[model samples]
Target: MTPHNELRLLPWSGPDGKPCFLSTDDTGGPLSRLADTTETAQLNVGQEILGHAMDVLADEEVETEELRLLARDLATALRDTLRVAVSRGHRLPALDPSTPIEANEGLRLSAAAFG
Candidate 1:
């Protein structure tokens, strides 16, 4: 069992698009693995959409309908990215509020930590 504070925010939503979470100490469990895969896929999709949006913006022949579609995609990607950030950020090591900031200099953050 995992502590409530240690609960992991799932990569997908639940009923009514509400946030979902997992409570487990098993980081390598099936659900954990699924969430990891989902997060990676979401990030890849966001990246691709960002590139497409840039290309669309650079074209003089772009239509209003096409711009609408781009906006939709961008909104979805931004939501996914924010969710991933919140989930990963919560999992990061906490620093002592009273400790000198330099005492935490050894900590490093990377995508691999979340995945």
Candidate 2:
């Protein structure tokens, strides 16, 4: 079995909405491929959510119930986007304050805003 530290933690949730970790050393392995596929699907869904939100905002006759439903959907999409970002960010090694900003830019940006 691969050591816990060596396994890759996937960015998306499982069927039960729980985090999933993979033990494969090969990036092209089945689990890794599945993760890649799932991540793509998530991003696509997030984009679709944004488009739907735009439609809601553009509608002049949108009802209060429709607005509430749109807000809930946006919240869910935001949560999923944050989860994926954190998952991908966790894969990076810890960075020191002295490290160049360009190196590990995602971690630096997110840590500053979200930490």
Candidate 3:
């Protein structure tokens, strides 16, 4: 069970595009499962947006409106992805200060690759 101060990480954002945290002890309850399912769907949509953007970019004569629409879609996907990532990060235990620095080298490398 989670402590009162520790809110459960939800997998989805609220209607206003804010991260949603649950203050429930039942982490494995029906509502939690539903949130998990919804999160999966949102992630899938993000993936699809990436694919669609790729297709749009590959076109020889993309219109300005098309590019604008793609940009909006990408923004939405990025927001959702960030929310999901933050929620998951909150659920993880803090890294020990004495742990080997090499443990997080992969994350740094990945971030650099994206950067």
Candidate 4:
């Protein structure tokens, strides 16, 4: 069986809003390139939205409705950013399973803090 990390989590959704995946060794393939481009665009848009949000927050006269709209847009950008992060994270090289657990001290600490 292929390792879970080897199966890429695509940047887009599949049927019924389910997450899509790619399981190919070709990193330079058409689909991979497309996903890369899309992730880039999404991140750029997210950056723009964050800048705009900061500007909006600095305005004391900002209305409730405008703030509400900004909130929705921010939510959308956050969703896209998270998707990109998840996809990229899965694509990273897997850690050696034979390595000692002490090598993952930070990971263990994080898990303990969260769990």
Model 1 CA deviation exceeding 4 Å by range: 1-5, 109-111
2 versus 3: better TM-score goes to: 3
Off by over 4 Å in 3: 1-4, 9-19, 100-115
What local lDDT does model 3 show for residue 22? 88
User: If ranked by TM-score, best first, what sequence of candidates would result?
Assistant: 1, 4, 3, 2
Candidates, ranked, lDDT: 1, 4, 3, 2
- For each candidate in turn, give its C-alpha RMSD to the true structure in angstroms: 2.1, 6.2, 5.9, 6.8
Q: Per-residue lDDT for 12-83 in model 4, tens only? A: 888899989898878779998888888888889988999999999999999999999999999999998898
Among residues 3 or more apart in sequence or in different chains, the pairs in candidate 3 whose N, CA or C atoms overlap within 3 Å are: none
- All models: lDDT? 0.90, 0.73, 0.74, 0.79
Total clashing residue pairs per candidate? 0, 0, 0, 0
Name the lDDT of candidate 4.
Answer: 0.79
Error of 3 at 109 (Å): 19
Q: Least lDDT summed over 10 consecutive residues: which range in candidate 2?
A: 106-115
The list of candidate 4 runs beyond 4 A from truth reads: 1-5, 97-115
TM-score of each: 0.91, 0.67, 0.73, 0.77
Task: For candidate 3, write residues 1-115 as lDDT tens digits.
Answer: 5464677667665899676778776657898778767667778999999999999999989999999999999998887777677765666556667878788554433331221
lDDT for residue 37 in candidate 2, whole number 0-100? 74
Candidate 4 lands at a TM-score of: 0.77
